[model samples]
Each structure stands twice: as C-alpha cells, then as structure tokens.
Target: MKTIIKAPPRRKPQSAGATTNRPGNPATGKRLPYGLADCVIFLAIAIPLLIAMCATGRPGA
Candidate 1:
C-alpha cells in the first residue's frame, strides 16, 4: 500500500489595501524637523570656513 501526503494550503498575497496589518505610517508625525538642527549644523561648519576664507584672502592666490 502506498501513502499519499498533501501539502498545506498557501496564503494569499497581501493586497495593496491591506494596511491594517502593517506598522503605523513611517511619516506619521514630524519625525525629522530638518530646519533648526540642520541650519545650526550647517552654519557651524560653514561659518568657520567662511571666516577662514576671509582671513586667508582669495583662493589659489
């Protein structure tokens, strides 16, 4: 006598509208307020360069 084995059923592919099972929106809130910190950091790096350029005179001179 031969034995017959059946495979388990497969799950359906998730639909585009199936967000309920997904995690909360990645951009739910102001996750990265990029203004103040970015400006401060940019200025922190830029102001020194600007002062150095002014103190050293024109470039390639």
Candidate 2:
C-alpha cells in the first residue's frame, strides 16, 4: 500500500490601492531657481547728470 500527500496554495499579486502610498507634501516653502541672481542695473543718465534734470519739465504731463 501507498500514501498520498497534499500541495500548498499559491499567493496572489498585489492590488492597485497598495501602489500609491505617499506620506506628506514635500513642496512647503521652496525658493525659485533664479532668485535675484539674474537682475538688471539700469542707468538713468547718459552723458552728464546735471542739477537741471531733477526738475520735471512737464510735471507729470
């Protein structure tokens, strides 16, 4: 006479809900890439800055 044995069951794959499991928000207070580094210096006068230039000729015309 002979004896019989049983086999174990296989495991199923992970579901969809288990994939997206994030903790918290990362971008709380982030700085810009070009923060004041890329600026421009504009010069008002061209040839000579005279005292007469201070007076607005038209006065906000």
Off by over 4 Å in 1: 1-33, 58-61
Q: Write the per-residue lDDT of candidate 2 for residues 1-61, one digit (tens) a residue.
A: 6877777887787899877766577665666755353532122342235445656356775
Off by over 4 Å in 2: 1-18, 21-23, 26-30, 39-61
| Residue 8 C-alpha lDDT in model 2 | 86
- In terms of lDDT, the poorest run of 10 residues in model 1 is 21-30
* Candidate achieving the largest lDDT: 1
| Model 1 lDDT per residue over 1-61, tens place | 8999999999899888984754477666546658788989999999999999899897677
Each prediction's whole-model lDDT (CA): 0.83, 0.56
The true-versus-predicted C-alpha distance at residue 9 of model 2, in Å, is 31
The root-mean-square deviation over C-alpha atoms between each candidate and the true structure, in angstroms, is 9.3, 19.5
